[model samples]
Target: MRNLVILGAGTAGTMMANHLISKLPKKEWKITIVDQYETHYYQPGFLFLPFDIYTTKQVKKKGSKFIPKDVRYIQEKIELIEPEKNVVQLEKSGELAYDILIVATGTKIAPEEIDGMAGPEWYKSIFDFYTYEGAKALRNKLREWEGGKLVVHITEMPIKCPVAPLEFAFLADSYFKNKGMRDKVDITYVTPLGGAFTKPKATKALHHLLEEKGIKEVTDFNIERVDYENKKIIDYADIEIEYDLLVTVPTNIGDALIERSGMGDDLNFVPTDKATLQTKDYENIFAIGDATNLPASKAGSVAHFEAEILEENILRYIKGEPLKAEFDGHANCFIETGGGKALLIDFNYNHEPVEGTFPFPGIGPLNLLKESRMNHMGKMAFRWIYWNMLIKGISIPFVSAKMSEKGKHLEETV
Candidate 1:
């Protein structure tokens, strides 16, 4: 049997596993998935954890449980990926060779990249909500902790769930308001980008919300280091922003094995064909999700969309056929605003987020770029869809892998 080895058991990896198991001939292919993690986290739930909207039990499930029985699942640390020899060396298990390899070992936050970020203040005042432990810690910190200058910051971009920090800012605004401490606390949003978000229209709408909510906005601030002693963050321009508590999204990088293999870029993300999702140099290797240096948002929806295209391409590859499907960098995100409302944005590589009804034109149950209670409910309902449909390799009803222009209202340029 030809070996098809997959790295990582995260969302993208798991979905790919389930998809291939159903497509590939059982007699011709033997699939095995490797991951060091035992538990699979619903990462989006991390955003809610700090706000006490989700409990620890709600965010975690066994990684192996989601994996299909037909495929072999190994829990172990990957030491290196020798792509030249089609070998994967594990710390404990012996080296495994594969005919085809899928690199889905997603990005990780490297807080130490910034000076003094992982110092004594870590987990105390300097916190991150990206990891399970950090989110839980921040949850505790937010509780019984009187209001002060709370700064929601991002060290750099290409982080998973790009809208999460903004969501945190909006949620914090509402949280403090509910606690009657809105007057007692001061909030600031710090980012390296020149605007509130990557897209212009979304940024304008979100920036308006931040201003209306009285949350201070500091953009284009390239973080230099965390001043632990002074409780401040200094930027490259030598400007200092003081804070009582810092909830930061640290610099995101790919898995160390990618760097060790010499197959990745400076940030360790594997260099991939922007349209095909195939590694540029290695024809036998394919990359999906945040593992590849795709210029798309490293969000679950992007990964989910990529999986469909990847599944088709892998099948074509095995049959000695050309890859027909192409990934468009499509991304869908829900931006939660304060007080039981949220906004949804859908776009692809070419299209910026536009204001129009989604799924159904002119008459959408969910509005785009505008806040609505229905959108908030849709956001909350996604957790259920993620668990039941997404990771299980099931397609979402009425949602296509490609971004649709049917409902979007494109702005005319002169």
Candidate 2:
């Protein structure tokens, strides 16, 4: 029997486990998934944690609980991935050979990459909301402390849930307002990008919301270092931004296992085919989620879309068939605009997010590029959907892997 091994048990790896369990014939193949973490986190919930919108218990569960019992689940660190021999060396367990390898070890925050960011000030005055611990710490800091300068900054792009920093800024606006201390706090959003978002149309819409909420914007600020002693962040251009509380999304990079395997790029993201999800260097190896250097947004929605395409492609590869080139970089995101309202945006590699209806053509119960209460309800409802449907590999109704352009208002200005 041939073995199929998967790395990491995060959103992507766990879903692949659930997808392949029923597909591969039991007599023909065996599946195994490895991750250092036993606890699986609903990473998206990390955004709401600092604002006290979600409790600690709501975001995590045992990684084993979501993985199929039929699949071999190893809760151990992956020491190395020797692609040349198709073998994976575990920290304690001996080497495991595989006929095919799926690398889904997702990206993570690297605060150390920035000078002084992860130094003495980390988890004290300066914090990150990307991790469970960081979010919880920031939550406590926000509770008793009277607000001062709350700077929501993004160190670089390709971070998980790209819009989360913006959501934090918006939510901070709402949080302080609710505390009746809106006048006491100052909120600023600083990013390396030229605008609030990546896509042009969405940026225009989102920038307006930033203004509406009175959150000051700072764009194209490439941070050189954080002056923790002076309570300020210094950019390469000599621009300085002072802050009492700094909520920053540090640089994001893929797992070091990819680097150890010599199968990754500079950032350790596996070089993968943009359409097929196959590693460019290895025919039998595949990659999914933030681990791959795909131009797509590194969000769970993109992973869910890729999983559908990959499941089919893997079956083709098994039968010695040419892999299908079908993934289109489709991504859907919910942007919280504060005050019980949110906006949704959908797009693919070739298209920017525009005003549109989602799932149905002009009949969506949700609106795109416009803030509404229904969109928020959809965002809140997604937490439940993620656990029950997304990670379980159950297909979400009304959402397709490939993007549809039927009802999008793409006829106007780009």
Candidate 3:
């Protein structure tokens, strides 16, 4: 039997395992998934953790639950990957060889990359919502607090869920207002980008929302270091921003194993074919999700869309056929504006987000680039879909892998 090994059991790896199990013949193939942790986190829900929108229980589940019974699940730390020998070395277990390998070891937040960011103040006054522990810590800090200058900053880009930091700022505004402390607190969003978001049109809309909500935006500020002693962040331009509570999204990098294996780029992200989702250097190895250095938003929806196309491409590879260049960097996200409303944005590599209907042209229950209660409902409902349909490799109806331009107004190409 041919052995297939998956590196991580995160969203991307889980979906690929489930999808492949159904497509590949069980009699001819043996599948194995490896991960150090037992629980699988709903990373997007991390953004709402500080606002008490989602509890730890609501956003976490055992990795074994989502993994299929047919596939072998190994819970252990990965020491290194012997790519040349086509084997994986675990910390405790012996080496395991594979006929095909999938590298889905996702990106992680490296707070240590920023000086003093993870020093004495970590989880006390300095917090990050990217991890479950940090989110829980932030929740405790936000709970008995009278309110002051709260700074939401992004240390760098290519972080998971690019819009999450902005969403956190919006949610904080709502949370403080609901507590009747809106007047007592001031919120500031700092980023290296020139605007609120990476995309141009969305940035304009987001900038307006920030201004209207009384949230300050400090743009184009490349952080030099965090001065924890002074409770301030020093940027490359020598600008200093002080804060009482700092919620930062630190620099995100791929798994350290990627660096050990010498198969990754400067940021440790595996160089993947933008169209095929296959590693640039290895024909038998594939990459997905935040693991790949694809020029796309590092979000869960992107992984879901990539899995659909990758499933087919994997089959084609086994048959010795030409792999389809189907992935289009399609990504869509719901920006929670709080107040029981949200806005949705849909775009791909060649197009920016525009105002229109979504999943249905001219008849969407969710509107694009416009805040609506329906969009909020859709955002909340996604958690259910993620557990039931998405991880099970069930394709979402009406949502194509390539973004549709039918409902959007595209005046300029991305």
Candidate 4:
């Protein structure tokens, strides 16, 4: 029987497992998924954890629960990938061979990459919400903080859920306001980008929200190192920002196994076809989600969209057919704007986010590029959808892998 090996049991890998098990012939193929962790975190919920919007129990689930019984689940750390030999070496389990391989071992935050980031003040004054432990620790810190200068900074980009840092800022604004400490807490948003976001139209809208919320914005600031001794972050330009509590989104890189495999970019992300999700150098290998060096937002939505396209391509490859370049970099994100309001943006590789309706043209239950109460509800409701529909490889109704121009205004391109 042909063997199919998948790395990582995260969103992308889990979805691919479910997608393939249903399509690939069970009698002719054997499937196995590997990951070191037993629990799967609802990573998006980490943003709300510090604010007490989501408790620890609400965002945690067994990794095996979501994985199908038909697929063999192996819990072990990967040592290396011998791509040329079509085999994988695990720290605990022995070597495993595969006829087809999927690399979905997603990116991880490397706080130590920055000087003094993981030093003296780590989990004290310095905190991160990208990990479950960090989020839980920050929750305790925020609860005790009466009021002070709160700096939310990004050490670098290409991090998972690019909008998460901004979401945290917005949520903090709402959190402190609810606690009657909004006036006492001074919030600052620091980023290396020239604006609030990568997309121009979205940045303009988000910039306005930052100004309106009284959150100080510092752009084009390349972080050099964290002066832990003085409780400051100094940019390359020698500009310093002081904070009582520092929430950082550090540099993110792909799995170490990819680096050991020698089939990845400088950052360890697999070099993938921008449109096909196929590994550029390996015909039998594929990459999805944050594992790929795709110039797209490393969000769950992108993975969900890519899964559909990849399912098709994998089938074609097995049939000895040419692959289709169909991925359009379609990404839709919900931006929490404090209070009971949030905004949604939908766009593709070439189109910037524009104002209109979503899921339906001109008459959406959800508005695009505009903040509304419904959008906030939609954002809150996504966690349920993520667990029940997304990771299960269930196709979302009315959502296509390719982006549609039906709802957006094209003339407002920035």
Candidate 5:
């Protein structure tokens, strides 16, 4: 039997494990998954943690729970990946050789990369919701403290869940209103983007919502340093924004081991073919989710769509056949706009989000690129679907891996 080693038992790795176990011959392929951490976080649930919408118990579980019994699950830190020799060095455990390697190690927030960000005011006034500890701390601070100048900021782009900062601002608007202190707090949104979002249509719609909510928008502001003493953030152009309580999304980068292995790009993401997800440097190694330097959102939906195509390509490679480039950067996300309402957006590489119904033509229970209470319900329902259906490698009914034009309304081009 030959060994197949999968790194990082996150969303992508877990799904791949389930899919391959059923398809690959057990006698021929002996699969093993490795990760340093034991807990599996429901990453989307992090957005709701600061608002008290979700508890710690709801977002965490043992990593071994999702991993199949048939596959060998090893909990150890990876020291290096010797791609040329097909071996991975572990920090505590010994080295393991693999016939095929799947790299699913995801990106992480690195606040230390910014000067004065991890300083004295790190967890005091400055906080991030990207991590479990940060989210819990922010929750406690928001409860007891009286609101003043509250700023929701994004340090840089290519961050996990790009719309999360906007969601935080929107939810904070509703949170303060419910607390009867909307007049006491001043909420401001600061981003490096030109508008509220990346996509044109979605940005226009979200801009309207921001205006309606009375949340101030500061755009094109590239951060330079954090002024912990004065509670101000300075941009490259000498512009400054002061805040009483700052909730920021820090700079995100791939695992350090990737850089040590010389298998990653400037940001430590593996150089991968956009469609095939196979690493450009090594044919035996492939990446998925936030591990690949693909021009797609670092979101879970994209990983789910890519898993099907990746499984097929892996099989083709095993048979010495040509691999199929089937991935099309399909991504879908739900934007929580507070006040018991949300918006849904779905698009691929060639299309931007437009107004329409989803998963059905003119008969969707949910609307796209538009705000509705039903959309909020759909966002809430996803947690159930994620745990019960997605991790099990079960495809969502009526939703194809590829983007469809059936229920979508295309925008008019000039």
Candidate 6:
């Protein structure tokens, strides 16, 4: 039997395993997946962890539980990937050669990338909600905290779940109000970008929401360093923003294995064919999720969509057929605007998010690019879908891999 190895058993890799298991010839191929830790985290839940919306127990589970018994599950640290040799080196298991390799190591927050950001004040006045430890720390900090200047910041773009920081700000607004301390809290949002979001249309809608919630915005602020002693973050132009509590999403980079293998870019992301999900260097090597330097949003929904397209492409490669460039960067996300409401946005490479119905055209119980309680319910319900349907490679009902433009009210770009 030929060996097919998967690196990282996160959302992307796990889904790919499940997808390929049923599709590949069982007797002809052997599937093996590798991950260092035993726990599989619902990373999206990290955002809700700080707000006490989800408990620690809710966000994690035994990784082995979701993996198929038919597949080999190796819990070992990946030392390096020798792509040229088509072999992966593990800490204790030695080198594992593969007929095909899939890299799904995903992106992680590199707090240390920013000077003084992870210094003496880390987990004290400085915190990040991107990690489990950081989210729990921030939760504890907020428990007894009297109101003060709260800064929700993004150190840079290309971070996982880009809308999360903004969601944090919105939730803080609601949280403080619920605590009867809204008047005492000063909320500010700081970003490296000139607007609230990457896309043009969504930014306009988000900017209005921020304004309505009384959250201040400081844009075009490229952070230089954090002055921990002064409790202020200084930008390149020397502009400083003082904060009582600094919650930030630091620089996000791919796994170190990519760097060790010398197959990744400056940020350690593997350069893959955006459409095919195949490594530019090796046709047998594929990448998904945050591991690939795709121009799509680094969100779980994007991974879910990419997984569908990738499975088809991989099958095509195995059959020696020309791969179809069908991936259109389809991504959709629910932005929590607080107060039991959320706005859903769907878009792809050529389109920006706008108001419309979703999954069902003109009859959506879920509205797109518009705030609704139904969207909020959909967001809350996703955790269940993630564990039961999503990671298991079960296709979602009514949600096609490629985005549908029929339901949307499209607008021409200026």
lDDT of each: 0.93, 0.93, 0.93, 0.93, 0.90, 0.93
Give a tens-digit lDDT track for model 6, residues 86-188.
8999999999999999999999889899899989999999999988899999999999899899999999988998899999999999999999999999999
lDDT of 4 by residue, 1-414 (tens): 999999999999999999999899999999999999999999999999999999999899999999999999999999999988999999988799999999999999999899989998999999999999999999999999988899999988788988999989999999999999899999999999999998898899999999999999999988999998888999989999998899999999998888888988888899999999989998999999999999989999999999999999999999999999999999988988889999998988888888988889888989998999999999999999999999999998888889988967865334
Better of 5 and 6 by lDDT: 6
Question: Considering only N, C-alpha and C atoms within 3 Å, which residue pairs clash in candidate 5?
Answer: none
**After aligning candidate 4 to the native by TM-score, how far in Å is the CA of 197 from where it should be?**
0.4
Error of 3 at 10 (Å): 0.6
- Give per-residue lDDT, candidate 4, residue 107: 96
lDDT of 2 by residue, 1-414 (tens): 999999989999999999999999999999999998889999999999988999999999988999998999998999999888999999999899999999999998899998999999899999999999999999999998797898999998878888999999999999999999999999999999999998888889989999999999999999999999999999999999999999999999999888887888888999999999999998999999999999999999999999999999999999999999999999999988789999999988888888889889999988888899999999999999999999999999989999888889763324
lDDT of 2: 0.93
- Tell me the spans in candidate 6 whose CA falls farther than 4 Å from its real position: 412-414
**Steric collisions counted per model:** 0, 0, 0, 0, 0, 0
Output the TM-score of candidate 2: 0.99
Q: Any runs in candidate 1 off by more than 4 Å, and if so which?
A: 411-414
| RMSD in Å for model 4 | 1.0
Off by over 4 Å in 5: 411-414
**Which digits, one per residue and each the tens of the lDDT, describe model 1 over residues 28-67?**
9999999999999999999999989999999999888899
Q: Judged by TM-score relative to the true structure, which candidate is superior, 3 or 5?
A: 3
**Candidates 3 and 5, the one with greater lDDT:** 3
lDDT of 6: 0.93
